[model samples]
Target: MKWPILQAFPSFSPRYLRPFLRLCAQQSALIIGKKLHALILTTGLSATQTSFLLNTLLHFYASCGDILSAQKLFVEIPHSCKDIADWTALMSSFSRQNRPHDALRLFAQMLENSIQIDDVPMVCLFSVCAWLRDVGVGSQGHGCVVKMGFEGKVKVSNAMMDMYGKCGMVREMRRVFDEMKEKNVVSWTVVLDGVLKWEGVRSGRLLFDEMPERNEVAWTIMVVGCVGSGFSKDGFLLLSEMVFHWGFKLNHITLCSLLSACAQSGDVVMGRWVHVYGLKLMGTEMDIMVGTATLDMYAKCGRVDTAVKVFECMPRRNVVSWNAMLSGLAMHGRGRVALDMFPRMIEEVKPDDLTFIAVLSACSHSGLIDQGSYYFDNLESLYGITPKIDHYACMVDLLGRAGRLEDAQTLINQMPIPPNEVVLGSLLGSCNSHGKLQLAERVLQKLTEMNPLNTEYHILLSNMYALAGKRQKANSLRKVLTTKGIRKVPGMSSIHVDGHVHQFSAGDKSHPRTQEIYLMLDDMVRRLRSAGYIPNPASQVFSGSDGIEDDAMDLEEKEQALFSHSEKLAVCFGLLSTKPGTPLYIFKNLRICQDCHAALKIVSKIYYREIVVRDRNRFHCFKQGSCSCCDFW
Candidate 1:
């Protein structure tokens, strides 16, 4: 690839200088390009071959990210000598720098100056419009393309399809695709993405099958789209097809997307399988992205210990990797371990805003008040990171959890920024836990002012009232919410069995194995009662008519209601479906109630099986009548 030396060739020949300039641009060798430019000018080649060299110079400056230099060179070119390629180079430089507005402005200037438009510049302009998601500008570009008779060109037509698709004009995008006399993989892929975004996974899958040929990108898009649409199982099937049927090597992106799907669906079994398959594909050469995704997947699936192993196995770690690991630890209630990792992390890479969030949350969850306070105090001075709202919320949570209600309130009042609902909600949660009825009322008032329609705050306050034996007040709150038609989110629990996720709600009988599940539930209840298990009546949030306390219901009936809880049903179904020694992994949409949490500990010991429940707050690993949280959560 070596070029002839300057003295070794005819300096006046554009042929020799053109290739040399191209080489410099490709290598991003600014000094070499400038020297070559000087050689061209000194030899008076610029006077005769000005137009040819100017376009190359513009491209060189554009490639090197010197947009200013390129602009200057572009402006100095004589108006008659200026061509569409020069404009494209300048427009493309701005586009590459994410300056779509500037690129559009150049296009407007080209129109005003009466410059003849060509397909190349038109394609660049359409791409700029797509990046901006500006449907108005894209439509105008489309008209110009048609006027210039460039719509017949395949690349220009593909750009048009991409522009309309990105702008959310799906019908227009499809029309362009349908009318195209020629179509390539890019054409099919662009329209497929639009269908996935505007339509759902089913329609996207339909169009995907219609494609004459598929590439890695198309497969990856379907996988990611399926994951986002809550069809992770289908995404896995697509991956299997791509691998087993097509024999395509799984790229890092596809692997990461599959891992993300597993995490979202809480499918740890499939996550482990994907991890092993990724190892086979990449072997020991797995990059930071895939490794980080694996760590996050294990962490999110309630396997923090295995996530730690993945983190340790990574050949290289970045700030993102550290943050993912720390968040996982924080999420699983391993605050002490997360804190220990922070010092080591800072020695290699500086902590960012997200890092502090993870560290502070770890302290809050672990009730390390002293450590949390020290970190909060030194956030600005030592770490040069200011305490954001999330940090304030965590500090408030830590203080409240430690029974410092007055101090938590004082800190909230002293916050430089107004406290958000999350901060107020944390304080309210702690208040409920500590039975600070008066403080909880004040926090609830502020929360109501922030978001009146938020039924969660109301429910928390009502539950607090019920726990305090203020049955009348609790009923009143429930009646008001019912009148307004503001119902709280229903509790849901899901368990992944045999690669399919089964979800259950309170009193749900939608599953095909309902009869078997109920029989197992009956057996579990009899065993539990014999083991001296008594339902905590105070945790019965939905036991009565319209969520009112069922004062007339006897103890046995209340116990029946408790057993019908979503988590209980999921647990019973797991017990019936899984092997005796198998561990049950249950994911819940809300916090585990006091009754369920207590009952699960006994169930773990009596059944002689480990049960890992990932509730809204944290992981609860119940084993032998003990929970990993030590009953703190």
Candidate 2:
């Protein structure tokens, strides 16, 4: 293994040194590998005519992550010494680095040259295609593999499944899997993961049950599918089955999946339960990933203080861990806390795109205009995190929410890329909030062109017209919606109690306890009215604004509209079911309306309950007539 000994055998042929270089390539130590490379070069043991030594050298560098050196040698390789494996090695390096564009281009070059490619390179290409989620290239690769008869190969077939699966093409991936004559655990797992992505967890569970033999990965996929598909309770059930019944060791992946489900559903009880399980599984030695997930779940479930404790106590912190805390704070509207964590995070780990996005979102949700401006302005220069559409969207939302309508529009105009629907929608929402009819109309026109079928813009514009007292325009808009058969998707709110989630839409009365829920609602409204609370009429105007004639409604009708909103129904149900002083957590599909927020504040005081509402934008913790976000949202 010593390079000094390689020179002692000065008469050794390149063939004799090939195995050692191959061994070096497999082991992958930069310093140890560089030593071997120096030995080959110094001894002139690497022949210019023979490609075996060059291929091994290239593989050594590429696999060792010295990709630049591999690329240099790859480009300079003599025509006679070049081989398909050489290109594949480079492609794999790029693929591992998530640089699929470079890998795909190199693969195209191989096809153009008509090089004699086999399954190894084809498999690598498909793997990159899967990561890139490029359906076109994946189809081409699939065809090529079939023509070359590599489709029969398990590795190649599995790669196709993975590529299609990640692309959300569940049927294609399943087809590839079903046709494969020989299958491995990875083959089943890849297809199952793909199904989970496109299909729901129920579908993924069916697949999991159908598997002839389930491995750890199969179990992990089902757990992930359940949590990712909004069935956190199901995910926990799967995790328990995997560990207790199947005798599979509880791992970080399983724990993380459960935590993710708890975060998504805002089930603090389940989140804490998962936290306890993670501690039991890992003991005092907590992994960074599991710790991060636990912290994220607590923060998202309205326990920011607990998340902070976890962040401080984590044995090791990474970019991902820091991003989780920052994003969680952003979700809870703790923008100042998130910003304060940034400098400390900088000293520990370099911020990436996700980091900046979290920071920008925190600023946007918390009205940190100056802080948001600094981060959005200097993100690229300071952190080298290039701003994508989401980043730009956050910046626009920040500016728009701050009443800088013209500045938000200017930022949209100045975007290096065209503004997406989210950016345009943010500007439009600002217009709706500030009653800027002219800007709202301009933004609406662009939005309608971008997504002609979506009725949200139409509804928003109709609201704008009604708010501006343009009754004729509002009526014309409603007529257009009726003519086009466009109906707005109704907003919904959900609350989890004991293990089941109860969901309600606007004016909902479908719950089995609907009678009792409304009765409780009457009591709550009476109590709130007695406490000097009044139903906001503005809340009435937007209540049935989807083509409804709000101008025709009387004051009493408006009050009924406020009382019938989905969140109000869910809260009333909570009051009916839960104990006094118990916190009520409600999650809304859309932004919590000003009226609902105002009502919840008084309800919190009247009921002597802490009410937590997580809407589309951020968390609002209502306690004793005040909110955590302070009405900023």
Candidate 3:
């Protein structure tokens, strides 16, 4: 298919050869392009009158994706022969390769030398600005565009809106969009994306419905935008709308967004749907991103077995894929298995900061205090990765949970970065669990000073006072919270049945089946008593004080408090609704109190069921009157 342009023109005339080189450049013919570069250098055509021949060669190299060759030629170009196009060609090449830092440096050099750029190449500069979110440089580019009179160009204006949006100046983006004389689909999409970033999905949806025409990218962006904005349920609906009503085919981006929504909401049914949709669309050609997201979805939804299947069957695994599996195991309290994967991970793939975090978290949850310490010590020395705040948080939790509070405090004091709320919170939680009130008081003092608005720490301190029989101190703190309008966040629990998520709270009787659920609870209590499950009376009084009255009033109060706990209600509902001995999974918004954890262990043994519960901090798997955490959690 190679054309003989030079053979036809043996004299190598400028007119004939120039036309032939331009054709080869447009075709991006690398071999012919190289021959033409050699011809120009040997004949000294570039030095005779102009460097149009050299510039054409530059375009040819760049267009063929030979960025290194194009950069070399541009560097060798004579100062007199170089023009705006020559500068733009090299800049565009770097920008297209995602080397924005290099691209911007070249732009700065162009400005220093006063090389004029037309509107077309200005798009590349604006794109780099958008991606980097460099407001100062972008404003300078905007000023230059004004001076050069490219203000009315649609592509330039679109890029400007994108840059402004990424810089968090949504008002300026809207102004540019309003001022533009002509607007295209890209302009609308950019504004829509900006709205999603600045606000929520509702605003973006309004703009999307108002658009004159929508392309595939615009539709996909809208769907992903909802997931990113934390309106994951809305994201799922939009995906359905796109496929069913708009007749848009499901792409990798759309599927990944949907999987994220499924994970956030813990909607296993919808996750299965997305999984099926992926198989239907790709049919043996699974995208690694889609597969990794699927693994994440299953793991977060408490189906670790399914996640393992997906991980094993994946055609390929990247670092992210391995991290997802490790995180999944850590989250679901399979810390032993999670730790087992580490040596294999080191053999095959390199572990980063996130990998160590997952490893430390697994060790913390499983009471592998020694293993957690080993990883924390070797994090920098063995892995050559600096320990971030999350890794430090896991270590603090590890030491504090193992009753090494002094070591935990020393680690915090020795942290390279200032200890944040999470590190302090982990220590405080361990303090509350192990009855270390003095350290709790000190941590609370620092926390309250750091964030006066945070009532959770205040509540924790108050609860500690209540537990220690300092009722006046607890009452005084409660009065101050009421005065500051800081009400405690009520704990909530939810269980997924079929596709619907049912919620329960302390004393919650809002469900239509409340009567049936309560009746089921009564039956469960009768059976539990027969099987030697007596309620722990200490749970009723916030104070763990000695000498409880066995009077009728005291007994009634204890019974009412124990029965209305949110997790108990959710568990009773699951027991009644599902088949016998079926595995039940529940998610709780707060840490599982000691009484609830104790009650669930007995319930599991009596009912012959396995219950997987995820509380605020970690997972608890109850079966046969035993918990996976072995009373350490």
Q: What is the C-alpha lDDT of each candidate?
A: 0.85, 0.83, 0.82
Model 3 C-alpha lDDT per residue in residues 235-320, reported as the tens digit of each score: 66877887899898878987887788777666777788889999888866689899999999998888889999998888777788
- Candidate 3 lDDT score relative to the true structure: 0.82
**What TM value does model 2 have?**
0.88
- Best-to-worst ranking by lDDT: 1, 2, 3
Top candidate when judged by TM-score against the true structure:
2
Best by lDDT: 1
Q: Of models 1 and 3, which has the larger lDDT?
A: 1
Instruction: Write one digit per residue (lDDT tens) for candidate 1, span 1-633.
Output: 244556657555877777878888899998888877777677566476866687788889888878988998998888877888788889988998999999999989988988888898888988998999998989998999888898889999989999998899999999999999989999999999899989988999999999999999899888777765657578778778888999988778878877887787687766787899988877887789999999999998988899999999888899999999998998877899999999999998888989988888888777778998999999999999988898898889889888899999999999999999999999988888788998888889999999989888888888788778897898788777889988778888888777677888888899999999999988888898899898776677632211334556777666667788899899999998999989999988888877888899999999998999998888888999888877675
- TM-score for all predictions? 0.77, 0.88, 0.72
Query: lDDT score of model 2?
Result: 0.83
The runs of at least 3 residues in candidate 1 whose Cα sits more than 4 Å from the true structure, single-residue gaps closed, are 1-200, 225-234, 448-453, 469-487, 542-558
* lDDT against true structure, model 1: 0.85
Of 1 and 2, the candidate ranking higher by TM-score = 2
**What range of 10 consecutive residues in model 1 has the weakest lDDT sum?**
542-551
Clashing pairs in 2: none
